[model samples]
Target: MQEFFAMGGYALYVWSSFGISLLGIVYLYFEARKYHKKQQRLVRYWLHRQSKKKSS
Candidate 1:
């Protein structure tokens, strides 16, 4: 396993790169969900307003 950990003396850098990529993916996922919810809310609001206007 020593050879595996060595990774040609670049284990630390390789692991750090993988960790940063994972964090970026997680951040993007939450941001995308928030954006989708906001869009849905805007659509619902517009539909409600249209219906109200039609009734008047």
Candidate 2:
């Protein structure tokens, strides 16, 4: 197991690369969630306005 993690003495580079890739995926997930929520809010607001206009 230790030898597998060592990666022939390139552990630092290998682990850092893996960490950065994981961070990037997490960041993208949060960003996509934020964008989705914003779009949902916009759609709800538009629908509300249309309903109000129809009632008026």
Candidate 3:
């Protein structure tokens, strides 16, 4: 267990890298969701405007 944790004395580097990668993945996930919702809203707005213009 200790050996695994130590990672042959490279534990700090290994752990830091893993932590950074995890943070990046989490950030990307949230950003993607936010952008997706924004895009949907824009599309809906545009469609509504087009319909209104056609009616007028």
Candidates sorted by lDDT, best first: 2, 3, 1
The list of candidate 3 runs beyond 4 A from truth reads: none
Cα deviation at 24, candidate 3, in Å, is: 0.6
Q: Could you tell me the lDDT of residue 37 within candidate 1? A: 100
**Candidate 2: tens digits of C-alpha lDDT, residues 10-54:** 999999999999999999999999999999999999999999999
Candidate models: Cα lDDT each: 0.96, 0.99, 0.99
Model 3, residue 29: what's the lDDT?
100
Better structure of 1 and 3 per lDDT: 3
Clashes of each: 0, 0, 0
Weakest lDDT window of 10 consecutive positions for candidate 2: 2-11
Score residue 41 of candidate 2 by CA lDDT.
100
Clash pairs detected, candidate 3: none
Candidate 2's TM-score: 0.93
Model 1: clashing residue pairs?
A: none
- Could you list the CA RMSD of all candidates, in the order they appear? 1.4, 0.7, 0.8
lDDT score for candidate 1 against the true structure: 0.96
